[model samples]
Target: MKSRSPLVNRITIVVCAVVLTSIVSMATTLAVSKSIEGNATAINLAGALRMGAFRLLAQAAGPGDNHNTAEPNISSFLDKYEASLFDRLITRAIPRTADHPLTNQYRAITSYWETTLRPGLENHPQGSPVSVEMHANTETYVDSVNQLVSMLERRTEARIGLLHLIQIISLAFSILIIVALFVDLRNRVLKPLRKLVSIAGAVGEQDFSQKANMTGSDELAQLGSAFDQMSSELALTYYELEERARSKTEELEKSHAALQLLHTASRNLFANHDLCSGAVPMLQELEELLGIGPIRLYLHDKEAAEPVEVVTTASTDRPFYCRDHHCNACLVSPEDYDELPIEDNDGRRLLLPIRTPGKLLGTLEVWYPAETGLSDTARRLLEILSDQLATAIFLERQITEEQQLTLAEERTVIARELHDSLAQSLSYLKMQVARLRRLNIEGDQKSAHESILEELSTGLNSAYRQLRELLATFRLKLDTPDLATAMRKTIEEFSTRLGKPVGLNYNLPPQALSPNEEIHTLQIIREGLANAVKHADATEVIVEILFESPQVKAKIRDNGKGLPVGEQPVNHYGLVIMQDRARTLGGQIVVKNRDSGGVEVILTFVPKSRHLIPTEAPST
Candidate 1:
């Protein structure tokens, strides 16, 4: 909670200041003491030299010469001489022994007296050149005093100069220390702290989007780490909440779509319509609603000795049978219903039984991988879909039976009309022609004539048109053709009608296209040509058909003025009709503009029987 930086800084400053002050005080005191000692030493040396020279001159001049004043002069000179000698020795030796500034001055004065005064006094009688010698000593003393004073002044100046230099150095060092302290605070502590504060402020504002670039393994880095932890936690929490909300929304959507499909399927099945046609649509809606990969159907046989023995499938050409004779469901009872995993090179398979109150249909087998196994909810939905599909199948069988009865009645009526109209007319015409020939033989042309000829021609044209219509109907009623040839024929018809350069190319192996595929291909080709004529101003057309092992394909190309892809025209029912036909046959239609200034319509045909392998009938 408490920081030590400020306190540490304050103590450092105080210590530095105290050390600098002490150094300055010591330097100044030493300088002043040296200056005072130099000045005092110069003055004392000059005074001692003066006294010794005066006393020595008096001593040499007295003693029985100038008899009356001799004794008194001699006594006074001797006393002065003794006192000067004492003063001279003490000033010179004592100062030198003490090692004071006066020692140098005393030695200089002693040399001056000995060189000029002492030699002159010893060379002549005591009183012989006393005044000259005394004058010389006095001059020498004055010169020596001037020189000593100058030396003392120079010494004092040097000491003061040293003191000034020391003070300057101390002040400079103190200022440098203070500047360094300020710089350290700015670079190391204060700047980093400010950076941390800015980063924290940004984070507090919910801006975990940006990060701090703090470096080093310092305390600031630790703070940066803490900030990172908080930011990461907040970001993770927000992401988790967002994901949960999204998941719930998606689940709700799926549930609503599933319920809607159930409602629609129920309505369609109960209606008195073609249930076979409706069942496919219902299954497709269910597939889209529940995101089913693929779907199939297996039905129980009502006309067989046993339902399982003669099971049927929604696939027109396929008969249903159990997966090997001894499959896991072979002896499975209703209460013991379970799923068995079947693995093959293609993928995994799941075999589920279709059961009602007291009857069992052929098992509904699905092929999917292990990872994408049916969930319980999905299985339940499938169960519902399967039940609904069975009811629809039952209704469709009923519709088929009724349609068969109605078709038989219509055939009988058409046969009757053919017999009544054409046969009776032919019979009457024969008799009339027979009588006309007899008249011609007898030369009677007035009663016979153009009436018979015109009537015959009219009836013949009518008969021809009726025959063409009948042939068209019969072609439609016959079994579905081989898809490859059917597609080619349709394309050729379109080319003739359009009077354009058109061609059909098929890519299938011989006899590979199945019955359902043949019909679908025919429908697709017919629709594609109709589309080309209406939408594409095509001059050259090409129809390509391919029947591979797994799927059938028809690609129609035309060099024409291309239309915008996927932009369905408002009144364009032709393309919609094509798409509807494809959907009915469980196929897809894709239209796009080809590179060579043309439109290409692709029809992909997946035969329902490919996924539904037929079961061989049992040997009687």
Candidate 2:
């Protein structure tokens, strides 16, 4: 459809109106000017005729003897006046209605000139009486001409006022038309443009609801339509972008939450040394973090032939017990299993196998709502948590085994001590008592019997003393797991018992020994202290434990009478035991008589591995 532009149409109408007003104004002005010109012309013609009649009269009355010439001049002036009057009357330059007397006077003048004055002038000479009468008529004619001229001047002034009035009306009309045009333009163009500008600003501010509702077929209307379309599209795109941003933000939050969950689970697992107790909090954390329910943990029990339920965040009604590894999800390795939640008879469940580098320890199982199963982040977090759990379990088991082994070794040491020292003494005592009884049965003499009884009593006392020492050795316990603390306690105990100040110089890092190593080391120190107190007759004792690169050296020295002269060191059971302990520690023991006075027992050993010293102390 070819629609006319409203702006163009409005402008065209305005132009036409202005042009029409201008034409009317021009025509009125021209008409006024023509009227004025005609009035002026008529006034001049009347004046000229009046002047000519006066001149003619003057020439006739001048006393000149040329009356024929004056008569000719009067005839010529009469003819000129008649022609001017005819022209003025014919052209109607002077309105007959308002100027009726003037017109009548002009007509009478012309009649008198043609009929009376002209004939008289033509017949008589200029000096005659008829000429004098003509001169009087000329003066009346001049007065009428002046009245006509004043009338014409008044008419011209009236025409000029009418022209001005018309021009004022035209100008007012033109101004009205122009004001209308301006209003039309303002309504049609400027107003809509301002509205469009406002809408554009609103769009820039991301407020797309505002619209340019201009209702016309003008260019501005088209622009508004295009703007509306653009706003709609921009709003749609903005909504899409907002949705995408929201989704991304949600995803990022989820990822951060998952990472936090993983971090917390890892910290819990590694923080607590007790696997069974530690796993509970980690499982609870996982449950809360993942928004799942009834999280359960299982540990493999080789003896039971089934995985044992170790910890649970919820009730134990839904235990995941798999003995034969029949459940695919439970037995699958972390790498082999896909991280998707599995659907079984008991709702959706995610199974993550807790594993270490050596073996799979168990499975961490969580039951979730079917509609909102596990997300990938949760699954991955569970996987990481499972690995940490497995590591914790492994460490706990290894520590337990080490403790058990240490206990067994202690038992062995006790058994060896009993066998080596107390057993021999008891056996000797039993032999002596039996001999004394036999001697008594034979009715030996009193002196011999008393002597044998004395020997048996001495052997029994030695046996009792050895048994007491064995008991004390077995009763020794480390106050703390660190070797240095235990050794200090031992030194303090011995010093108090011996009623002598026992000096100790300890300079080894804590946890420098395995449990078993610490047990052996403590036992050797105990025996050395006992030997020093009982046999060395030492007044002061100094115990020193020092570490050199890859080797630990311990020494017990006393200010006592040196070992008996010519005594073999290996002959002493206590020295032998210390040597055995040192050998067991992959080291050697030296018992030397110090030049000062006392005997010094020194042991030096290199650990099997430098890495045996734990970076962190073991929790009790």
Candidate 3:
């Protein structure tokens, strides 16, 4: 947690070591270089001294006039030579030992130059030819100068070698320091950093158990400690979250299973005949779902407003829920939702209302041991089961009521059919008989009586035919409950009987129309087919039932001679009966002659999804 960085200090130390090594190398080099600084100049001056000796020799050998031009040149050159010999570059390069080779040679050269060469050049006669002795002295001086130049070069070369040695040592020291710094960084920083990187990678992969585990008080150690703490915290938090998630997962799984079981129960309830038939198995499933005790179901008639039936689990040998007179259901209306807090020698009893929207139809009573208590989950499940039970019972009752209403409506239609066709024929026959009786009484019972009798016979036969048609129409209900199946069979039968191709184009969804709508629609098609069979005298027939949303349309076409223009079929009430059925279904039918020489019977109606209940808003 400190803001201290040891790496900075370590780098500072390394830099200082390198800089110090460089400074020492430079100082050593500077000393050695100072020792050899002017050796090159000294070597050049020594060579020049040798050349001056040659000039002095040449001057001594020349004629008197040549000496006149060269006397001042030799004197000036000798004077400069003396001054340069004792200058800093030459004199300051003195060796420590008095007998050192370079120093001795330097002194010899200086003495020779001052003692022999200078005097020879200065004191010689002007313009005199140089003697052989003077030339020999000059040669000796040139030799000394060459030896001095060689010694100066050797001395300068030695100092240069020392300077190189210092530089080499400085480079080695710097290299050593840099290598040490790298090793230190590897041990102190780089290794730890690599470990931290690996740990960070592990953490990214949800492996929070990995730790940097670095020791010491360096920056990396502190970073590692902080990282480890973070990892620990993350581990704890993740573990807690995992526990909670696991628990929640268990709850969700249980809820899913319960919902699946409840769904299966509901499917069995509705898929079977009625609630009473499947009630025992449903109650047992509810018991298994809740882990509770025996359950009972009571049925109530909303119309009669009394408890009508009781169905319970087969587990109990006796009447567990109630005795006939001890039942508390009398205290509550069939539509009441109040709880029946009935407890008996059996145990605690819980009652769930089996109800639909705005109506209570029955109750599901569960009796459990007194020690066993229901959880909120189980109680909620029971409520849902009760709702499903209510829905199934309510739907079944609705189907029964619809079938009864349909039956009554059809019976009324049949009565109207009898009145319109068969009853009219019977009345006509009665009149004919009365006329026949009058003829017999008047003793004119010859051809007139026979005609009246023939008329009566025709009326009776017509009545009998109408009666048969009515029986056939009624028999359709017992034969095939499904309208499509009945229509298919009818089409096949008519094709077989008429010896003509009969096509059925049924395009309606099965659930689009109610049972009543289907019945009326199928019967209208049958009536059209019947009329065609009796009188159409045609070749082909086509029956089509189609649905456009909110509407069902049926068409029965026969390639048969249509009815006489504006006239009904004689002694037949098919059209009247079809009109009655269509009216009952809140639809219309048209029976007319096709333009292509046939009868076309088309009926269209809005199908009822429910029993014509007047709702405030239409359900989508």
**How high is the CA lDDT of each candidate model?**
0.57, 0.69, 0.70
200-276, model 1: which lDDT tens digit per residue?
78767866665556565556566666766767787788778888788657656766777678777778777834333
- Error in Å for residue 125 of model 2: 24
How high is the lDDT of residue 616 in model 1?
42
lDDT of 2 by residue, 1-620 (tens): 98678767778888998999999999989978876776766777766766766666665555544445544555565576567667844346755564576556556666666776556555556555544566666666667667767766777788989998999999899889988878887888788889889999999899999988667777888898999999999999999999989966875676687677667666766776534445555565556556665667787644334565656654312222211112122233444223333344335877888888878878888777687666776677677777777777778667755784677667768867787876787777777677767654446477787786777676576556656666676766654435755666787889888998899877654334666787788888888898888887888999888765447788999988878777664324667778889999999999888988899999888765332221221121
Candidate 1 error regions (>4 Å): 1-106, 110-132, 215-218, 221-620
Off by over 4 Å in 3: 1-445, 478-481, 610-620
Clashing pairs in 3: 60-130, 61-130, 64-127
Per-residue lDDT tens digits for candidate 3, residues 399-475, read 76577467857866786787688767777776767676566445666777677677667767766676766656655
Candidate 3 residue-wise lDDT at 577: 84
Q: TM per model?
A: 0.36, 0.45, 0.38
Backbone clashes in model 2, listed as residue pairs: 67-126
